[model samples]
Target: MASSRCTQKYAVGSPASSKASPLPSFHRFLTKVIQMNQLHTPKASRNQETGRLSFMAPVSPPRSGEAARGGLSRRNARRVKQSAPAFISSPCTFPTVLALKKIAFTVTSAALLSTFVVSPASAVDKDASANRPKPPAGMSRVGGELLGRTGTQVKLGVGAPVLPKDLTGRSWIVADAENGEVLAAHNPHWRLPPASTLKMLFADTVMPGLQPKTQTYTVQEKDLADLGEGSSLVGVKEHLSYTVHDLWLGVFLRSGNDAVHVLSSMYGGIPKTVADMQAHAEELQALDTKVVSPDGYDAPDQVSSAYDLTLFARSGLQKADFREYCSTAEADFPGAKKKNGKRETFKIQNTNRLLTGADGVDPYKGIAGVKNGYTTHAGNTFTGVAERNGKVLLVTVMNPSSKEPHAVYKEAADLLDWGFAASGKVTPVGELVPPRSASTGTGTGKGPAAAREEDKGKNGPSHNTEAVAAEGDGGGGGGVGIALGIAGGVLALLAGGVFLVNRRWPLPDLVRRLPRR
Candidate 1:
C-alpha cells in the first residue's frame, strides 16, 4: 500500500544567506502532527521498490465545521499563513509515537552534534564536556573558570560548523569591538613570539610621539644595523631622507622592519623605544606583552599574548591614520634618488592578505587592519578588525599550527566569520577589560580625527588614499546558536557560514573554495 503524506526533501542552502530558514521547514513537519484530529487513520503502505512508507503521515480527521467556526480568526489565520493550527488544544490526544519520535530525534541529533563541539561553553553538562580537549597545564585556552564568573564568554553556535575551519593557531581570541566582549578564545594568556603583529602596539605608542609628519630624516648608515638577517625590508637606503609620514606608510603597508629602525632611532634609540612601548603596554593593561624590540623580530624573552595583541589593536584603531594606512591595498612608495633630484617610486603592496585578497585569500568585507606577522619562531600570527552593520569585531590568532604561510590569514578569516555570525546570538565568554583608568597628564596621543584641518589638507591625497571600500550594513540576527531546539529537544547544527563572495571576476569560485588562509 502507498502512503499519501510525507515531508518533502530538504536541500541545505548556504547558512549565511538564509535567516531562520531552517526553522520554518522543520516547524511545518511538526504542524502536521499537532493538528491531527484522529478521525482519519494512517494507511500503512510501502514504495514498490524501496519498501518504505511513501508518505508516513498519521491521517487526522478534518476540522469540524463547528470547531472551525468556534475558533480561527482572519487575523490569526493571516498570522499563521494558513499553514498550521493556531493552538494544540488536544495534547492528551497526541499519539505516544510523537513522544517516542521526538525523543529519538533529539538523541540522534545530540549524539551527532557532540562530535563537533570540542570546546563547548562551560555551562554545558560535564558528561557531554568531559572529552573536550583542555590546553595542557600552564596553557590557558578559553579560560574555563573565568567564563562562569565573567559571563562575557560566548560559544559561536550550539553546534554550528562555524569554528575556524582548518585553524592551526594554538592561541586565539575573537572579540566584539563595540561591546569589548570576547566572543570565543583559546589559550588567550599563552606567551608566544608575536612577530609583526606587535607593530600595532608600536604604532599605537610611537605614531603620536612623531608629531611632525613633515619633518624629514636622513637615514644613518648605522640604522641599517637594526635589519636582521632573513627579515623583511622596505628598501630603505642609507643617506636617503624619508619624511616621518612616508616611513610610517612603509612601517604599516609593507611590514618594513628597516622603517621601524629609522623611526626608533629618531625617537631616541632602540632601547628607549622599547622601554616606551613597554610603558605604554602597562598603561593599556596589556600585561602579557613584553617588548624587547620595537620591530618585533624574534629576540630572547620577548613575547606577547592573543589577549594583549587584541588590546593593542583596539587602542590603535581609535586613531584614524592607523585605519587609513592599514586598509590601503596598494600605495606609491618613494624610493632613493640617483642624484638627479628626482625620486623613483613603486607600488608597495600591503602584506596583510585580508586587505589585499591576493595570495589565494579573499579580501574580508569590511576588513580594515590591525596587523599580520610571521617568523621562523612565531610561525604566522595575525590581529585583524572588521565592521558590519555598526558592529566591529577583532580577531587575533597567534602562531598557526599549520606549516603553510597563509594559514594564519585563512584561519583569521574563519574566526572573523564566526565572530560576525555569533554576534548578539551568543553570550560573551569573557570581557575585554578596559585600561584601569587614564589620569589626565599632558597627553601625547592625538587621534587622527582630532588633527587640525590645516594638517590634513597639507598632508594631501598623495600621502593617503580613501579606504578601498568599507560600507554600512544592517545588524545580524540575535539569539542564534549552533544548538537549535527541535520541539523540546536540541538539534545541533551550524547557524552561520562563510558569506563573502568576490563580486569582481571569473575567479570568484576559486576564492570561495581556496584552501589557503
Candidate 2:
C-alpha cells in the first residue's frame, strides 16, 4: 500500500515540477506519514518561518481522499503530496558528500570522523556505554591490555634465552637488529617513564631535519631556562652558540634537557618537537610510546616501553652522526667565553655506563652506543646496541628496581649476552606492531608499507626479515597483539555506525527519538 502510494503520479497530475533531488523530497513524504500516525493534522497550518508548511505542527489528518490543506497545488494535493514526497514545502537539499553511504564502512568512517565532534558523534551515550567492549574479567585497558600485554615469555627454539624473570627491570627487550626480530622480552610494551632514553626518539625525528655540524644555533637564556628540575644538563651556557653536533652530544652523553631545549628551539619548539617525535614514533610502529617532552622528563603521560625504546635505537642508529655521538665516550663542550674573548672548554662524559665503562660497570663486549636514562619516577632506563662478529643486537631496559640504580645497565648487559647467543634460535614472542597504514584493510594482520619501511633504514643496510615472527618458534607465543587487533576492529565498526546514522536519519534531532527493541 505504501509503495503504491509512493509511486502513484503526484507532480504529473497537479503540482508544478521542480529540479530539487527526489531523495530529499521522499524523506519529507515519509516524515508526514509518521507525523499523521502520531498527531492530529491541523487545518492549513502553514509555517510563517521558512515560508513553508510546518508538517510537524498540529495538523488535521486527511479525510478519506480530501486535499491536505497547503499551498502549491490545485486538487487535494494528495497524489503529489503522498507520491512525489509530502513536504511542508520544498524538500531541503542534502549535501553530495552524503554519497559516502555507498562507500565501504572504512571509507565512511573516515568521513564521519571529520564531520562529527564527540557531541555530534554521540553514538555511544553514557547510558549505553555499557555495550562497549569491556576488557576480560579483572583486566583493564589502563594496562593497555586491550591493545596488548607487555610481560610475556618468548622463545625461538627449545633452549633459547627468552628469560624475563632473570631481568630486574620492569620492562626490557633484546632484538636482533640485523634481522628486525625481537629475540626476547619482558613487559616490552609496559608503559613506563623513559627518562633521557627517549632522546633517541627525539634525535631520530629531529636529526633528519638538522644539518649536524653546519646548522648552528646560539644558546639563549630562554633556551636553558626551562630545564626540568634535577634533570641532567650538558653545561650549555647562555649566550654561547653551539652546532647541532654539539647539542646532540649533550643529549647522548649528558642526557641534557638543556641541550634538548636548545635544539628543540632550533627545530621549532618543544611542543612541535614532541609532536614530531610522536609522529615518528607512529611511523616506526613504536606503539607503546607517548612523548610529552623532548627530553623525556618525568612529565605526566610521558612514557615509552622497552619495545618502543628498541625501535627508537634501531631507527636512530641508521644515521652516522647518531651512532658517532652515542659511541663517543668523551667530547669537548664549548663553553661561554671569558670577558677577555677566550673560549672556555669543558669535557662532557657519556652517561652510558656500559659504553663509557663508568662506575665499576665492565663494558659489555662489542658495545657501541645508544642511550640511558634516570629520573625519580623513571628510576633508570637504558637502550644499548652492540656488534660482535658482524651481528648487531639491541637491548632496552626501563625502570629497573630503584634499590639498585646500576641494575638497569646490568639488566641490559645480561639481555645482550642472551640475544647474541639466542639470535639463531628465538622467534618474536611479542612483536613490534606497526602503526595503522592506509592501504591495510581491517582484516589484514599487517601492512606491506610497514614491512617496506622496516626493511629499509637511513644510510644503513637492509634488516633481514627472515627470522621474524613469520616462521614458527619455540618461544612462548604471545596473543596480545591479536587482542589489540580485535579491539581496534571494534573501534572501526563503531565509527562506521556513526556514518550510517547520518545517512539513514539525515534529519536533525531525530536519531534519539527512533524506536528501539
| Per-residue C-alpha lDDT of model 1 across residues 77-118, encoded as one tens digit per residue | 222112233343444333444433433443333332332232
TM-score, per-candidate, Cα-based: 0.57, 0.57
Q: Which parts of model 1 have CA positions greater than 4 angstroms off?
A: 1-153, 156-162, 403-405, 439-517
For each candidate, what is the lDDT?
Answer: 0.57, 0.56
Which candidate has the top score in lDDT?
Answer: 1
Q: State each model's C-alpha RMSD to the native.
A: 24.2, 26.2
What local lDDT score does residue 411 receive in model 1, on the 0 to 100 scale? Answer: 82
Which residue window of length 10 is worst by lDDT in model 2? Answer: 50-59
Clashes of each: 21, 12
